[model samples]
Target: MAYENVEVIKRLFQRLFRDEFPNLAPAERQAFEAQLEGRIEGLLRGAAGDGKPTDFAGIIGLGPEGVQPFEDINYPRIKPDFDDSVIPTQLHAVAELYYIWQHEQMKIFQVIDVLRRLFQLGQLRIQRGPGARGLYILEKWKPLRYSRRDRMIAYRRAFNYGTTPAPAGAVVNNNFHFQLVAFMSAFAQYFRDLMISEVIKGGVALSERPFGSAATIQRLGLDLRYALDRASYGNILALTTETGQYLREILELLDTPDIKRSFDANTKWDVVEQVSQRHLGGQAELSQRAKMAESGRRALEYIAANDFSTTLDISVFHAEGKALAQHAEAWIAAYRMTAEGRRFPGVERQLRWALGVGERTARQRLTA
Candidate 1:
């Protein structure tokens, strides 16, 4: 599957570049293909391990020795109730979402905290230029130092779909995957913060003093701009293209007649609810899943509408942020009830502290 994924990526790049440079000379095209293959090979070699499955326990900081292979950790098996030809594919998609949610819960919060601190320290300024409402201008920008091991863990979590290990080098050398994830994290924060600002202000404010005096919008703008500048146009196009495809696949699975019948679901959203409760966590609720599903669909439509343009649509951003924030908040509550959260109580406490929420308020929010 790892090799298949690499091949898929190669095909995507080939199609993208071919369309863009349809008039390339035969010799030039040959050289381009050769260089692309070499670059892909180099990425594979740069990762730390040979192409072997990673240890499950070790990757998540459980222990030195791996108790199980990463590939062994999978979504719950659907019972053999009906035609299940697409079950494996559906489960794979859900597992990817699970992986992303697990990491995003931690990483996205870290980004928010960083921006919150910068705001408190007066390091972020509100943008007052024309057409910059509810936006900020970062006073200074610094790349967050994410360790190689951490990056490898994230890579494996997202890409280790088959028995084979994912490439470690794929996360190294500021590769496209790394940049894509970074942009996503930043974007999530931007939207999440925008939601918070809107909630605090109760609507769009006429004043330019700063919406809720938050630094998220500003930092998000800078971070996105920085990511765009660093990444190639091809990389951006590929990212959007792949993301849209995955979203469509997931949505299709949710709406598939066979899947709905297998789960005895009444509506497409019911499938989401069932999957979330069974595989995501015990606390996964119907309402939360609904929000996530709706926002996901909206996101897919937004990507389709934008067509790979890096343009900011504030209204769309705010709407997405609002829905995603609600989902994240619910997810956090659910995660706290999980075994992992029980083992690491400080995680929530640290987040609460960073967000300047008192214990009472945190408890109230969780219970609410």
Candidate 2:
């Protein structure tokens, strides 16, 4: 078996060896061997003490749990990379455990599903360099080998063969791109550390200009021309989220320019009202346009059906237009109930309360 014996593992790998390196170039093999050994040692430590791991035998173990809370399966396949060939154990016993054990498949690659939400995460890293491609890399959990630089390099690499590789440039393409991914990951880690400090220090200003590897190095190069200008950076931060954020952006925008100063309640409300009006029309539809439109229709129907007294009841208790939409529904409901006569009891009470034109009825109120 490919697993179960170090000799078996070696032989299997030897088959893929296009060329053998029996004479490993000095520490080349040593570094690889040490990292592999360390990975195996990590796996062993995970297995020795545990109640029982479902995939105990098949996996080399991830971390100390002997398994990671990788997948949310009810009973099994909870950990992934659990039984992967890259388990790193060259020992015979561990190999045997892996080769002999049987388990359900785990969906580890599905983790990439979160990439869609990557935009909402912390700021993206924009790598700019000569001959670099613009990339918008979504920040993700660490220990992953991706970086901002890698994404940017990917764009540059894209030109080597474009979408499909060209026959003539195959060799050059392979060398340039195949080796650039690690730098991207390293840059990401460094950027993440920097962003956190900016957020705490610059607040909303930290997100001035948003870019990812999808951006061009030329664009960044031009931008960097004035990157040293703190005033420019502050103004840009106020308009769009960007790095090299200036704390003064918040102060200037608030007209407080003084961090040591504080705004009173009334002054703060003025700021809120001003900003609110500025952003009033910017609220995009939360879901599909159809869904939001339908919700709006239902909201108006509920308001027109009921008057203010009853509208309050529906908005709080029923889902429809906001506090303002309440009375319209109650007004509508009351109009319909008037024609119904006694069919709609307590309808008038709601109508009166909603309209604010009259007192609440003695017998029943909609809220009660």
Candidate 3:
């Protein structure tokens, strides 16, 4: 399905580029289109399918040449050292895996860049601040991650972002607000691993007797290892992208004495308290949903209808929900700090509705 979307996008790009680059000679235009097609297909081939490599380097666009579809072709392993047993074969395996992952990520970024260009988003006033932007991303992703009612709730929050404001003493906390998207986006793409990692980290506990079995334990260990590696890859991808600058800026903000003081020692306690309450509330809602279904078949139907993962995996849902809430809070606080918070302009509301709640909400959340 995603491959189909890419194909559609490629077609659109070809059409748009032809119109935009009319000055190019016929041969030059044809060559450029070929280049674009080649790059997109190569990247897709390189991307990992189901947590395993496609065994292709998947290098997108221009780079150092002679990088084989598999890294082993470029960096063949040396023979095993029977005597000293130094520089083992496992090291080569690890290296090859790393390179393949890197190249796949490179392709993801490249594709993202192409979309950004197509959207012409650079012309927009994205500098409105992190709070607004965070809200914007939440709105954008809600459709991708939620169902009808859930998505509508997200839409309301996005709407509120444009018109809400921080209370007198409340902090907008842009540091937390802006970087939310980058982390959440990365997490969304790698949530299976994130769930596994949470289990391994003691953040989520298993109650079943199966977990006590040696086979189960061994399988869990392997899963945890893979989750850790995948999480690392996701983090690296997030931190290196353009939005990742927000993550860097967040750290830099903490370096300021006054800004650092804004977060009291009780912040951790508050966060934990909020998370616990929200998790319980979510569980209650889930139970209510189950009752509404009233039967096994209906429950399956409900799950099928829902756009988001309705997995019994509470840990993953909690993490995702919390991130969504955080972005919403940040956006609201920032909106409140601005003039738009006092009384939202009706025209703006209409415009927001037309643009989709997320876009309007994000725009409204901008600092005055």
Task: Compose the digit string of candidate 2's lDDT tens values, residues 313-352.
Answer: 2113223323323332333333233322224324223323
Which candidate achieves the best lDDT against the true structure? Answer: 1
Question: Which lDDT tens digits does candidate 3 get at residues 66-139?
Answer: 44343322222133332222222222222232322222222322222232232245432233444234334434
Question: Each candidate's lDDT (Cα)?
Answer: 0.40, 0.28, 0.33
Q: Could you give the C-alpha RMSD of every candidate to the true structure, in order shown?
A: 26.9, 31.2, 27.0
Question: Best candidate, TM-score-wise?
Answer: 1
Question: What is the model-wide C-alpha lDDT for candidate 1?
Answer: 0.40
Quote the positional error of residue 101 for candidate 2 in Å. Answer: 48
Write the number of the candidate with greater lDDT, choosing between 1 and 2: 1
> Measured by TM-score, how close is model 1 to the native structure?
0.28
Can you list the residue pairs that collide in candidate 3?
57-69, 164-336, 165-336, 166-336
Residues forming the 10-long window of minimal summed lDDT in candidate 3: 295-304
Residue 238, candidate 1: C-alpha displacement in angstroms: 4.8
- Per-residue CA lDDT of model 1 for 110-206, tens digit only, reads 3323433444565534234321221122213322234334433433433332233444444211332222222234345555555566688886641
Prediction 3 TM-score vs. true: 0.17
Regions of model 1 farther than 4 Å from truth: 1-166, 172-216, 224-263, 269-368
lDDT of 3 at 56: 39
| Model 1: how far residue 163 lies from native, Å | 13
Q: Is candidate 2 or candidate 3 better by lDDT?
A: 3
Residue pairs with backbone overlap in model 1: 47-168, 47-169, 136-218
